[model samples]
Target: MTASQDIISLSNPVLLEKVDKLRDLNIGQHVPLPQLVVVGDQSSGKSSLLESLTGIPFPQDQSLCTRYATQITSRRHNKDSVDVRIIPGPRALEEHRKHVEGFHRQVPSNLEFRKQFVDILKTANERMGIRADVSSGSGTVFSEDVLKIEICGPHEDYLTIIDVPGIFRTTTQGTTKNDIVMVKNLVKRYIKDRRTIILAVLPSNVDIATQEILELAEEFDKSGERTLGVLTKPDLVLEPSAQAAVCDLVQGKKRPLNLGYYLVRNRGPNSGLEGHSELDKIFRKHPWADLPRDRVGIVALKEQLKSLLVAITQREFPALLREIVSQIAECRREFNSLGSPRQDEREQRSFLCQIAGAFQERARAALTADYGADSVFDQDELRLITHVVNITDVFNADFHENAHSLNFEKLGRSEPSEEVEMLSDYDGVRKASSIISDLRTLIKKANVGVLWSKEFVELSEIVTLGNTPMPMPRDNFSEWINGIYLKSRGLDLGTFNANFIATAFAEQSRKWSEITKIYMRRIIVTIHRFIAAALRSVCSEEQVRTQVWEAILQHLVKCYKKAMDQVDVLVEVEHRKKPYTLNRQFAEARSKARGYRATEQLYPKARKDTKQFGETQYVVNLDDVAKVAEGKNNMEQLQEDIHDILHAYYSLAANRFIDNVFQLAVDYCLLHGPSSPLKVFTQDWVINLKAEQLERMVGETKATKKRRSGLAKKIADLENALKILVS
Candidate 1:
């Protein structure tokens, strides 16, 4: 008879109840629920050992591949019954899930379960065919799906043992060199979970070194902390020397384990089932069975496991309470993160409204700088109206400062020669031509250039021979006005014209259009960012969020393209075709340059032989002469006059161009073109959407929905368990 026959009730019923709650809820996925994980080399009699321990019928044909993880959980109960479930692992195949789900759907209720289970395993494998190569690095891959069997019957000890697929050393027909690594990884994953206690099953018939399970156990649970060594098929250890070695291992004489080894006799893989009487006859006759009760049989191993589990539970219960609370909190956070589903049509419409309202409010706040006190950046909080006024001030300052900073001018453009030929040597004209070339260089550059007539250069380079000369030289007038262009705008009346300035202005206008394009891009990018933020807060599903983003982006692209095309059309059709002509100041400068043919005719001078006072010198200032010459304008004064007018016109027009560019960006790109990205987002795209189209666009996948619901239910289950544990 088995050892449980004498036991009246479970010694750790509360612990068993906790384990049941964890298993039923599938809480180990979240918080690593504690258990025993069984692993061993192939043909190590792992299946028989599990059956004897739990008294549950499992797939036992040696020819059939175990291809998946099997979890066996059994407890003593009033009646005999078995429950079977399939849990798809993380690496489980999609076709495998379909096969399993299909089976669950079509399975008959009144059928004999044990026989049906064998057929179910067979059907699942046939549907989920094996693939040897999964990746370049991995040689052979298989399913990690778990086949869980929960059993309850009279005289069964409460236990949960996971039977992993057997480890292999060599390549076979359906397995490869990679299969050896894959199987080991599968075993390690189960046993590596901290809450799991390792059960390293081995065959006494083989060398202990070949049992890879023992090596892995020592590697993961060094010092045998949570490891139990179980030796199966002791009857097969027929040689006296092999028997002595197995006996020494059980008694802890050699290679001592903290939780020592135990020996059991069972058929490893025969076609028919063996009754306990046949095993009892062999055990009664065998010399190894006489060693010790605690180290020899399945009954002793069951008792040992119960005592060990009880002690481990006592030590781990406090941590388990903490784990339950932690897991509950984690699940709650994840559930809230998933948010309430938008299954209702009204809910979808309301989400669009929220996105629309947030967009407009944020845009208005940005324009008005009314972000209330919680604005993150000081820059974001700055008033846009104030920013515009400040930028205009900067524009005005740049206009005046750069106009004064002309790099090319009349200063020293000519030098004095010692002879009368100096006046006609064309030195002044050569100097004037060089000055014009410099002006051309500064045409589109920020540092502009201005010029004056050669007559002006000749007049400025002169000097009075002596006071005996009755009238002062015209050179005096030029000397007085050397730096006049610094304070006042001046031009070479004899050389360039207003049309030249207009062509220069056109170059600047073209550059301005490129700059404005950059501005347009910046505005569109800012709006794109706002649209994405709006989408994230409104759309729950990734597919829907992506749809909204693409719609808005494509809309903006079309709008901006049209605006840019209009600018090019405007430039070609109207702006450049009109003939650039001279204005009033340009015409006046032309007349002045022709009249003042000689430098002597430019400024006021003393009378030929003045006797008003003996040798008293008096020269009229050209500034007054300039005031006088202003009304009596000549060629020299034309240079300064034209310069003044050009600056005035260009400044006004440049500022106006800037204003036009900015207004277009605000109106067409920001507020209205193609209704703007933000406005477009709020539009009823769903209005014309077909039922199937809407489903495809916004509907969640079955797997995603299942995952979300599963997490929520797990959270609730954990919370309830946490309350019980804590109390």
Candidate 2:
């Protein structure tokens, strides 16, 4: 080794050792692993070139023998020896998200020579469980695994170069289309590192344009800035002019790369330890006389590579550290996000507590529209959570003003009294006509009057039905009623039995009561239906991407599901809640429609008062109104009393129903249950999350622990390297 080379090597011991420590920890696979990489098309004599560089013989067979990426770290030493080690790929790291898997196994002892190198690979693949799972029996002939060979010799450069499996245009024996893709990807992973300088080898026999390695090198080092084009098998170009062209390419006759091409003649892989020196002899001196000695041999190539590696590494180390630190921040975020795997009941409980607590707080904030004024949620999310009150208001307006609905009582014909006239009680029948006359007079004076329509032949069939409550008149009833005066014929007034009139009214009254109750029950159902929907919107997944949601649900589904299932218990309570109060206007409207409760005896006080609500006056002459009930006792006014009491009661019931639904069913049962908001999961759900529900991954997986160890070691090594470089 030259004194200058030794000085360069010794000067940066920390940088080299730090890289070694990273390799030792197998941290490269997780990030862009930095190193010099060799890439070339199939059988481009890359093996021969490697042999010449390190003097290790490669098999000359046409078979794809160099299957994995082999890294050769050659340094000058007093005693010559080789040590091989296996470095695992990213597959073994659980945090590694890619689907690809790779192999890692080592040669147990010092490699004696080149023959054992190939043997070690074959043995490693079999030992590491590499074989074809497909029925074709093609076997696992190639892989992305790496084999590290550390060689020391007196003439070797203090350098590390990775030789990836050669890229092939077509598949040969026992290889599939997958083999081609795998090889390209394997080669790409190495050369894509910004720190690595690409060495693209091409055979002199093949036109340089035909080689794909040049394109691949350009993929990473686009301006040919870090790529050094190396030509191998220069002797294979038989024509003198062809040889001259090759020499011309080496001398920059064709468009020269920023890092120009070099030439080497690899006679054979089995060329002995003195192989590179033998190539340097140049037996046919005149054939190659035009070429520069520095651009034509392994000795010059090795020195050139050593100088390049030293200069580039020293120059690029700071940028490389910055990249590592940036990547470390990213990985640490991922590493922290994965958290820990929950392997035991205690760990699972703790893990669930952290997630559930976070979710519950967010959910509470979402439901109450209490996301702080500074909080920034999406428009859709804000609308959903904050504007639930809009739904409540709409629901309120719908049920309140619709008095003609089935939920309210009003006058309408159910069955004709002509049918009741068929009964043989003639005296009872004659009075029924007077009974109709009597009620008709009373309805006209009442403010809420829905009189029988013109279609009715008789007034007996008048029924007050659901939701169609009578409309209250705009004008005061007292003014119209006082205009009426009755003419007295002075005929003999007869006593009459009025039981039939009361019986008919009593029956219709019962029907109205039943219908109104049924309608209130339906209101309960409507309220809860919307509440259920609100529950789903509150508990559902949001836009954190597929992976975050999957991970959250994968761990929290049981807790969420358990809470949802128990929601019905709260809803049932809301459904059964009955209302007890009435709005003043609602009660007055109902009372005016059935005002027979203000009996004839109270007539003197009902004069000319524009009083409000239930106290409003409706005057009628006592003499004429009394005559409508001529000679009748128990059955005469009984139906009127029932109507007045029941209609008022229905208003109270309807108002009570509305309040209960919004306050209890929606607000309490869904948004704010007895203990907490509907968005909260029950304690039982978190406490009993199935042991199997979680992946036992509270940073708990073996792979994650291994990765953590690797990362910590990597950070430490990098910090050490930075310290030394700055120092």
The TM-score of candidate 1 is 0.58
Question: Candidate 2, residues 100-154: lDDT per residue as tens digits?
Answer: 2233334332345555766755555554335533224544666555667777766
List where candidate 2 sits over 4 angstroms from the true fold.
1-10, 23-28, 59-64, 76-81, 92-139, 152-156, 168-181, 209-212, 215-222, 235-238, 266-278, 335-340, 343-369, 373-400, 404-680, 688-727
**Who wins the lDDT comparison?**
1
TM-score of structure candidate 2 = 0.59
Where's the lowest-lDDT run of ten residues in candidate 1? 458-467
Judge candidate 2 at residue 372 and give its lDDT: 67
Q: Write the per-residue lDDT of candidate 1 for residues 1-727, one digit (tens) a residue.
A: 3222211133476665666566555566666667778888877888788767875455565434566678777777787667666666654455766665454312322135555766766655544453322332332246666667766667567777788888988877556677788788888888887677788898988998777788888887887878888988877778989988988888888777888888887655563577655664555665676667778778778788877766666566667767777777787777666554545555455444555565556555645656573352244212333333333333333322232223212221122552222211124435455554443343323111111252223222221112231221223323333344334444654444445454434533444443344334434433444445545544556876776565455565555555555545544432364333345644453343333322233323423345666653435545444444345445456454444334344444444445554555445545555455445655365555455544555555676567677776677778767654543
Each model's TM-score, in the order given? 0.58, 0.59
Off by over 4 Å in 1: 1-11, 56-70, 79-154, 170-186, 236-240, 266-293, 314-361, 370-550, 553-727
Per-candidate local distance difference test: 0.57, 0.54
